[model samples]
Every structure is written in structure tokens, then in C-alpha cells.
Target: MSFMIPSAIKISSQFDAGNIEVLDLTNPQDIQLSIRKDNQSDFFQWFHFRVQGAANQPLTLRVLNAGQAAYVDGWPDYRAVASYDRETWFRVDTAYEADTGELVIQHTPAQNSIYFAYFAPYTWEQHLDLIAQAQQSALCEVHDIGTTLDGYDLNLLKISKPTESEAPAKKQIWVTARQHPGETMAEWCAEGFIARLLDEDDALAQSILEQAEFYVVPNMNPDGSIRGHLRTNACGANLNREWETPTAERSPEVLAVRSLMQQTGVDLFLDLHGDEALPCNFIAGQEGAPHLPDTILAQEDRFKQDLAQINPDFQLERGYPPGKFGPETFTIAAFWVGREFNCPSMTLEMPFKDYDNRPDADFGWSPERSIKLGESMLYPIHQWLQADL
Candidate 1:
């Protein structure tokens, strides 16, 4: 009788935004793993980890608990992303076994050490780098609003052009993203928006700046982001749900941003996000809010139309049904902002799966496309301002 020996391939996930629990590493071909749940919450879907000593070797990794995740529908068409340098992430062959409830990732590593993630992670270091770079521009000012539950800085950027004769106060345009930490594409999009807003040579950006001031919070739940939680902060509180009545201990992140919005008064609001099940880019408007004005509805329609025309990657055909939030609508950021400010508030959702309208087999809905979408937002805002409503 002959017996096979288990190889010495190693796996780990102890770094930033890393979440994985190893089950069996006895065989590289059948390595077993499970995603760790968010702190104090049952939500678990995001996963990031590194594999070592498996270069040029075919391997199969299985997530045993994939069926029980918060969004099981996200698994059907999703492809896992991998990177050797952690800077350039590309999709690999991945499939979900409905019968076994396993998410299987198969790949042959070109390097001894390679990283994999649910999506391309936007790290805290990258966030810091983006803030530092943006602050160097004269049109931008960085502010440290408060500390998170984990003692991380909650940074906000205020961008506007200085003027001596202000005919009327520039409209206060508020943009926030990444309330769900796993939706890193939101921050990537925000970074692109900031970059173009500060660019001195971009005429569209300059025109928008002349009529509106931007208040942006790139990362809303830093604790959840750093802890690798999919939809909550340090205390397992979904920041979006706390907008109705945010507290200091449970959801200070929302309290701080909401308080600031109260002080500045929101004329227009946008909250960026990523939908796991959806396969296209779309906007969820605040039409469900009680007593929503027709003027605000008109503004929302025009903005969506402009965006669709600006980027074909964005479409208006498919999205959440109207009144999807139901009674819980006010708990969401967009609805709350719209109700409180009587302004045009929208939730812009990118996708974890490929954009079905303009699918890219190589890199489905990527950071590059998200950034371009962000840059394209200036046009609609300009159009809204030109309407002078």
C-alpha cells in the first residue's frame, strides 16, 4: 500500500482588511477555509489572505461557510481577485458549488507569495496617501473630525475655490462613501472625484467649484474597514442604520458626519456603495421619502439621465425596486438626508460582479472604472447648478 504525504503549503490572513479562518491545510488541492464574521455581528462575506510556498503549483481553496454568508447571491457570478504585488489585482477562476455551499477558487500562482481578496482592497495607508496628496492642492483643506472607536482618525476634505465677491453662498454638496467597509470601490471613486475636483486645469471641475463647495468623507466606518467587517463598525453597528438616531458609543461615526452636515446644511447629497448581487452600476434615489418635493425629484431624474449619458457603463434599466426600503427607509443615509434637508440625495451603487452593460471578462467592475465614474460626476453637478433651482 502507498500513502500520499501532505505538502507544507502555508496560508495566513493577519494583515490589514484580512479575514479568514483556516480549517484544513493538509492538502493544497483541497485546502479548506471559512470567512470570519464581523465583530459582534453575524455578517460575513469579505475575505483577504495570502498564500505562501505554492508557486507554479495548482491549488484549490474552498470556503466552507460561503452559503451562510450575508449575501449568498453574490457568489453565483463572482470571481475572486488575486495579486502578487498587492497593487494590481486581477480576477481568477472562481465558482460556487450550490450543493456543497462552497466557494471554490482555483489558481496557479506565478510567485511564491501571492494575495487574494474579495475585491481589490483600499488600505488605510492608501487612504492616508490620498488625503496627503489632496491637501497639497490649494483648493483643498483636510480636517480631522473625530476619532473612531478604534482610535483611528475620521478625515474629511472640504474643497472649494476662494473668491472675494460671493454673490450667494456656494451650494453645499456633500458626498460620503464606504459606510460598509467591504465596499472599498466607494473610496476609490471618492479619491478620483477629489483628484479631479482639485485639478486646476479641468474646466468642468473649476466650473462646478465656482458654484458649489464639496464636503467629502471618503471612509465612513474606519474601524469596520480596518477590522475587515462587511457592514458594520467596531461595535457591529451599521452606520447607515444609525442616521435616524446616532449615538456616541455605538455609532459615533454617523453622529460626527451627521452633526457636520447639520452645521453646513446639505444642498445635495450622495452616498456611494457596492451591491453584491447586482451586476450593473445604478443609482437608488430618495423617492420613497415622505413629503419629497417634485423639484427634488426632477433634480434626481436629471442627474441620473446625465450620468447615464456620460458613461454607458451606468444604466437606468435595472436596480432596486421603488420603495425597497419600506418603513426602514428613514434609517438609510440617503433617505434621511433627503428628508432632513429637502435636497436631492442619492445612493450610487457599483457592483462586485461585472457590469452587465459593459462587461470586462479580465477585470470585472474595477477600481479604474469606479474612478472614472467618480470623475464623470462633475458634469451632472454642473448641470444641476446651471439649472439654478
Candidate 2:
């Protein structure tokens, strides 16, 4: 027998083994792991652990702690990622046993060391690398949108128009991610979008650069992400909720972004995020915004219909309930961006749970799908630019 060490799984640097409370691994066939907060319930979801001395063996992982977690329903149809090299991640079979709140992940390793995560993780180091790449591109401009309270740069990458002649009609399109820092998949999707946009061979990207300017903020809440917080900033503020009347004290991130939108006069805005509870990929728009003209509504409808046609991953059905106008909290996405800018803006939500239409038992809602969805977004957005705004 070949001797192999299985000490390969490493959680994203933001989270620690302290944050991960391993409940039981008595069953070699079913190793159990759990997440932990300092004083909270046993409930956990984000998990990263290593397996040593188990080469060429069929390893089964059972993650216990989903029962009391925030979105327990998500686990039933989820799959986890495993990587022997930490670069190429593939899906493994995961089964959520409802009776005991256990998530069962089964994998046969050819090599001893393998890493696993909820999805292919886009770590902070990778974010820095992305920023470096964007800064080097000839057509790209990179800068700090602002600094988070914890002093992390809210990086903004701008890809300008390739030619001076195309300036007059060129529109500004904004895509931002990680409002909820736990949604690491959003960043991966953003990375894919940015990479595709910068590629010279990309026809859609070429068209977009000629007709529109792209502004991307790949990490909106670096503080929260580094802190391992679920849905809030370093100050415990939910950045998504502070859109309408964002103040510096409560949400400087929103304040900076809103100011930028005002300065640039946004033609399009997409806030990328992952849904903890939802099981589908969909765009939530400002359907009930007060005084939104029929023309704009038609444009929005066309955008959705066109996107659904292009990609099987995105659907118009199974999204949040419509909120009436002037309701500050409920109408955040629809009310503020649409009514204020009079531009097409949307909250594009991916699922923490599996895509109900096409479920993967091994890798539920993986990063590959998220990146593909991001690519699909370009088509619908291009449609919006070509026809409406």
C-alpha cells in the first residue's frame, strides 16, 4: 500500500478550525464536521477540514449542524467541492438526511490530500490577484471606490471605451458583488465576468466595450468577508439594506457606491448576490416601483425574457414577492435604484441551495454554474443596451 497524508483541506483563511467545531468522526465511512460561532447554537454551514492517512479509500463526510442553521432547507439539495490540487475543483455526492440534519458527502480519492468547500472559493488572495490583473490592462482603470471602516479597499475596476469615436453614446454598466460577504460564489462569478470582458477574442465583450463602459466592484464588503460574518459588514450593518438613505455611520460602502452612481449617471446596475434560502437563479427587479413608466417596464420584461431564452440556468419564476412603492425597507432594490436613477437596475440572486430545475447531487449550485450565469447576463444586458437604455 502506498502511504499518503490527507492533510489537504484548508478552509478559506477568513474562517478557522475554531469557527469549525467538528462534532464526530467515529464512522470512517461518514466523517462528521460542523461550523461554530463563539457562543451561538451548534448550527453551521461553512466547513473546511483535512483528511490524512486515507489514500485510495472511499471517504464519506457527514456535516452535522445544518438542522439549527439559518437556511437548513438549502442542504437537502446541496453538493460540495473537493480539490486534490486546490485549483481544479470537482463536485462530490452530498446527501442531506433530514431526519438527523446531517449532510453526507462521499468521495473516492486517488490522492491522499483533498480540499472541499461549499463551492469553488474565490479567496481574498485571489481578489488581490484580480485587482492586479485589472490594473495592468491597457483599457482598464483600477482604484479604490472607497475604504471600508476596517481599512480594506473597496476595489473598483473600470474598462473604458476602446475608441474615442464611440464615446458619445457609450453607456455605463455596473456590476458589483459580495454585499453579503458569505456569498463567495458571487465573487467567482464576478471574476469570470471580468476575465471574459477583458479577453480580446470575446465578441460579446468587444461589442460591450465599444458601446458601453463597464465598472466592476468584485468585493463590496471586504471587512465582513475577512471577519467570517454571514450577512453584515464589520460594523454589523447589512449593506444591501442601506441603499435608499445610506449614511456614512451605518453604511459607508453604500454611500460611496451611491455617490459613484450619481456621478456616473448609471444606465444599468447589477448587484450580484447569493440567496441563503432560495433554490433557484433569478433576477429580482423593481416591478412595483411607483411612477415607473410603461416603457421602462416593457424594457425590463424584455430583458428577462431574452435572458431566459439564452440560458437555462436563469428563470423568471421563483423569486421574491413584489414590494409596493415608498416602503423603505421592503422596496430597497426596486424603489431606490429604479426610481432614483430612472435606469435599469436589478438584484441578481444565485442560490445557496441547488438550482431546482437542474439539481446536481454532487455539487449543488457550484461556482461553474455561477460563472456561466454571469456570462449569460452579458446577453440580456446587451439586449438592454441595444434596445431600451
Candidate 3:
């Protein structure tokens, strides 16, 4: 009698933003794993990697530290994503066992090589392509701002009126995303923003460029991004928190960008991120910024109104509560910039889960929608700049 032998299963996370610490594995049903903390930091949540050699096997991978993750609420009713070809990602059955603090993933792989992620990954190669696409435009200028701790080039794009013009730009506008490397949607949205800005046919792009210079940093933490860390950089420093006193050794990414912002000076800014617990797209500002004049506050309101008119995805209704009145905490990028520049600044967040208001069963708050939201932002930006100029 001949007996069939199933091959040994192999798992790997040796690529960009990949994170998974396997605990125990026999058959698929009791595969145990834990999310690795970001470098030296205790923060953990994002996970992505590949599984192979076990096809057509029913698997139940359990996250051992589910309750200990940064956002435990993100697991309940949240489905994990899987891919066979890496081009198309679909949700797999997922549930959280609160009593055991386990996030269980149920899947039966159709192919030997299958991948899983907390969400669809937006990779570094794609980011380079985005930068290249922007550079194709004469209005776009690429800047190698600084070096990351891991030695990856920190890039920034500047788009505005041609330098041949006699007068300099009237305003300096800044937009940076992906300070938390796991918030991949932020860069996807930035891609849309870059595309819309470079489109020669877009009147809003042209108008906005005529009035202001844009400094767009698509990926703020390349080290954390490529390492798949949730919130910290190569040495475990949170870039957002380091804004107050960024050092070249620990947070060169922030130090470089902040230095440039100091040189150009910020008239307005937007810091983009993804929120695990929230299922909506919204904006948060530092109302606690010192002596925020009512005029600037009114501008914030008007800009939000314009945003609502422009993009159906954005809402001002649900967001982080205002910080109680106090001295500005420069630890937060938005608060630091709002206080320092006294400009209209905001922290824009997109949900990691499905947008509950307009849910998509097949694909949750997807990369495509995030990109579209980025494109739509041009309207409010153009309108706001027009009024000011």
C-alpha cells in the first residue's frame, strides 16, 4: 500500500513591513502566533506574511496576544485578508475570543503559497513608483530630504508654480502620511493626492499650485514601514511623538522634514493616519493649541464644510475629542505645528476596518477608496487657497 505524505508547512516574514512570530504549529487548526513588537517598542498590531506547502488544509491561526494589541476592539467583527496571487486580496473568516484573548483566523488555502495580512499591504516599491509618477510632471520636484536610521532615502515632493515666475509662491502647504508605518492606507491616499495634483487636466490642481507650494512626504517612517512595525521607527522612536525634540540619531526622518518645514515655513498642514477602532474617515485638530484665534478656527470649520461638499467619504461629525485647554504638547505633530506656525492644521484618519456608514462586504475600507479620497481633497484645498490668496 502506498501512503500519501503532506509536505511541511513553511512561513516567512522577511520582506517589507512583514511581522509575525510563530509560536506553535502542528496542523492548521492549532497554529499559534504572536505579533512582534515594533523593533524595541512594546507596541504591536500590524502583521503580514506568507504561508506555503499546506494546500486545501483547514487552518485556525490564533493570535496569542490579541487583547494586548494596541487596539483590541479592532478584532471583533473584523475579518483578516488573504491572497493567492497577491493581486487580489479577499477577507477570510475571523473572530476574537475575548475570554482567551485570542484572535482566530479561519482559512483553507486553495494554493500552496498563500499570504495573509491585517490589511492589504501598500509596499515600498509601489511608493517609489508613486514618486516616479509625480516626477514626470514638470510641476513636481523630488527631494531626497534625509536618510533613515536603516539608511533608506527619505523622499519628499514639492509641487507648485514654475520657478520661472517672477514672484515666489504665496503659501506653503504641507501634507505628510504614514508616521505609523502600519497605516498603509495613508500612503495609498497620498498616491491619489499626488496623481490628482499632477493631472494637467485638473483645474483645481493648477489653481492650487498657482497659489501655494506643496511639500508632500508620502512615507514618513521608511524604517518602520519596510520592517512592518506598527508605530515606531528603526530604533523604536515614534516619529509623531519626536516632533517636539527630534534628534538626528533617533528620528532623522522627523528631524529632516521638520527642518525643511522650518525653512519653507508652514501655512497649513495635514498629518494622515489610519485608526483601527474607528470605521469612518474624519479629521482631528488640536483645539488646545495656544491662543488659536477664532479666525483660524473659522477657517477650519469652513474647510471642513468644503471637504464634506467635495468628498462623501469625509466627515467632521466623528473624530478625536478636543484636548482639554492646556499648553500645547509638541509631542503630537499636528499640535506642535499648529502651535508653532499658528496655522490651520489637522490630523486626517481613515478607518482600518470597513467604513461602517457605507460598508463594503467584499472589500472593506479599501486602498482604492483611500486613493479616491485623496484625489477628492483637492477641492477643499483649492477653495481654501483661493479665498486666502
Candidate 4:
């Protein structure tokens, strides 16, 4: 009698922002796994990996700790994204076992190798390419502030109207994103923002630049980003929590950016992020920061309303409830900058899920939409600052 050996099914996550702790792989029908917690922090939810040798084979991969993830609310109504060619990703069948805290993904790949991720991934190579493209514009000045824990460059970009004088009078507007690394939509949004700001024909962008000098940090945690970790640096420190007491050893990324912020005073600061559970794009203010000014609050309200008019993707209806922050000692970027510098600061959050107000079942919340949102923000930001004028 001749017996055929079952072909081996292979799973790999050994790339940028890749994470999945394999437990049992003997049975494709009952493959078991758990997500690895971010280094030095307790955040875990992001996952991206490739599965091979299982073309046309039915398989079920289970994450044992789905309920214990950083955002359990994200699992429900969330369909995992999968791609064969990497250029386009679509929703795949996923089920969450609430009682067991397990996320079960069932798929049959038509290709030899396919990627599955919580959301579409934004890789380090794409990030560098974005920077290189933006650098070609005469208005941009790229600066490698310092070295990250993993030895990657911490890039910061300054974009403003080209002036003949050594120094031009303009309000210093700071926009930084991707502090958590896993919130990759932040950088994509920044890409749209930078592209529009550097456009020669845009009258609104020109008007914004006339009054503002932009300091933009496209990625704050290259160490965490390149390592495929969800929310921590190489040493397991969350960059957002390090803003208040950043150290050279633990959080050089924050330390370096903060130093540069001090060198150039900030008039308005925008820190972008992504919320796993949310289905809309929204902004969080420094409501709990010390010395609360009525003007800043008014500006926040005005910007929120005005932005909704500009972009239908942005809504104030569904978002994080504010007033959860604290004093100047707080480590968050928006709150810290607001309290220390008396400047209006905000945290813009994009969703991993689709926008409930305007859903796209196929692509869900995507990089293209994120970039459009970023482009929409320039006009409102320019208009809001007019209150000061």
C-alpha cells in the first residue's frame, strides 16, 4: 500500500509590524495562535502575516487571546483584510468567539502566499518612499532628528512657503503622526497633508503657508514600526507616554522631536492616531490640561464643525469622550503641548473599521480615504487660525 504525505502548511509573520505567537500548527482545521504583546508595553492587537502552501485548502486560524487584546471591541463587526498581490486588499471572513475571547479566521487562498492583517499594513519602505517624494519639493526641508532605539532615522519635515529672507514671519504649525506605529493611517493621512501643502496651484494651501511654518513628523516610532510591534519601541516603551518624561536611553524618538519643538515655538499642533474600535474619523482635545483657555475650546469646536463641512468622512458624532486627561505632567502629546506651550493641540484618530456614517464594505477604512481626510484638514486649519487674526 502507498500512502501520500500531507503537504505542510506554512505561516510566517517575520516582517515589519508582523506578529503572531504560534501555539499549535499540526492541524490547519484547528491552528492555534496568540498575538505577542508589544515590547515593554501591554498593547497587542495589530497582526500581519503570510500563509503559504494552503492554496484552495480550507483553514481556520484562531487567536487564543483575542478578548485580552488592547481593543477587544475591534473584533466585533471587523473583517480581517487579505491580499494576494499586496496592491489591493479585501475583507476576509472572520468570527469572534466572545465567550472564549478567540478570533477565528476562516479562509481558502487562491494563491500560494497571501497576507492577512487586522487592517492594511503601511510598511517602512513605503514610508521612506513618501519622504523621498516629499523632499523633491522645494518647500520641504527634511531633518533626521536623532537615532531610534533600533538605529532607524527619526525623520522630521518642515514645509512652508519659500522665503527670500533668512527667516520669514509665520505661525509655527506642527503636525506629527504614527507615535504608536500600528496606527499607520496616521502617516498615510500625513502623506496627503504634505502633498497638498506642497502643491503650487492650491490657493488654500498657499494661504495656510503664508501664515504658518509647518513642522511635520511623519513617523515617531521607527523602532516599533520596523519591528512589527503594536505599541512600543525597541525597549518596550510607548512613545506617547514618554512625551512628559522622555529619556535619551528609553525614548530618544520623543526626546529628539521634543527638543526640536522647543527650538521652534508651536502655534497649533496636530497629532494623528488610529482607534481600533472606532468607525469614524475624529479628534480629541486637551480638555483636561491645566490652565484651560476658553479661546482654545472655541477654536476646537469651530474646527470640528468646519471640518465636517469640508469632508463627509469626518464626523463628531462617534468618538472618544473627552475630559479623561490630566495636568501638565501628563505624557500625551496634545495635552503636554497644550499645557506647556499654551497652544491649541489635538489628536486626530482614524478608524481601523469602516466609517459607519459612510460605509465601504469592500475596502473599509483605507489609506486613500485617510489621505483625503488629511487634505481636507488644511482649509479648516487655515480658517480656524483666522480667529486669532
TM-score of each: 0.97, 0.84, 0.95, 0.94
Model 1: residues with Cα > 4 Å off, grouped in runs: 1-7
- State the lDDT at 358 in candidate 4: 91
lDDT of each: 0.93, 0.74, 0.87, 0.87
Best by TM-score: 1
The local distance difference test score of model 4 is 0.87
Cα lDDT of model 4 by residue, 1-389, tens digit: 99996678888998877888889999989999888888877888888888988899898999999999998998888888899987688888899999999999999899878999887888999889989999998889998899987789989898977665765577888999899988888988998999999998998998888788899999998888877777888999888888889999999998998898899988899999998887889988876555679888778778888889999999988766656654433688888888778878889999988888899888888888999999998978988768778
Q: Candidate 2 on 1-389: residue-level lDDT in tens? A: 89975554422233422134555555657666776532222224555545655677777777777677767867765777777876777777888889998778898778766676665666677789989987787778997778888887888898975667634678888888988777878888887788878877888888878889988889888876765555667777777778877788768888898888888877777888887768888877777666778877787778889989998888887887766234564326435777777877778888877788998775678878888877778888778877843
Please, what are the lDDT tens digits per residue for candidate 1 over residues 1-389? 99985557889988889999999998889999999999999998999999998999999999999999999999998999999999888999999999999999999999999999998999999999998999999999999999999999999999999866946789999999999999999999998899999999999999888889999999998998989889999999989888999999999889999999999999999999999999999999986567888999999999999999988988999888878988789989999999999899999999998888788888888999999999998888899999984
Clashing pairs in 1: none
The TM-score between candidate 4 and the true structure equals 0.94
Instruction: Provide backbone clash counts, one per model.
Output: 0, 4, 2, 3
Q: Please give the lDDT score at residue 162 for candidate 4.
A: 66
TM-score of 3: 0.95
Q: Order the numbered candidates by TM-score, best leading.
A: 1, 3, 4, 2
Per-candidate alpha-carbon RMSD to the true structure: 3.3, 4.0, 2.4, 2.8
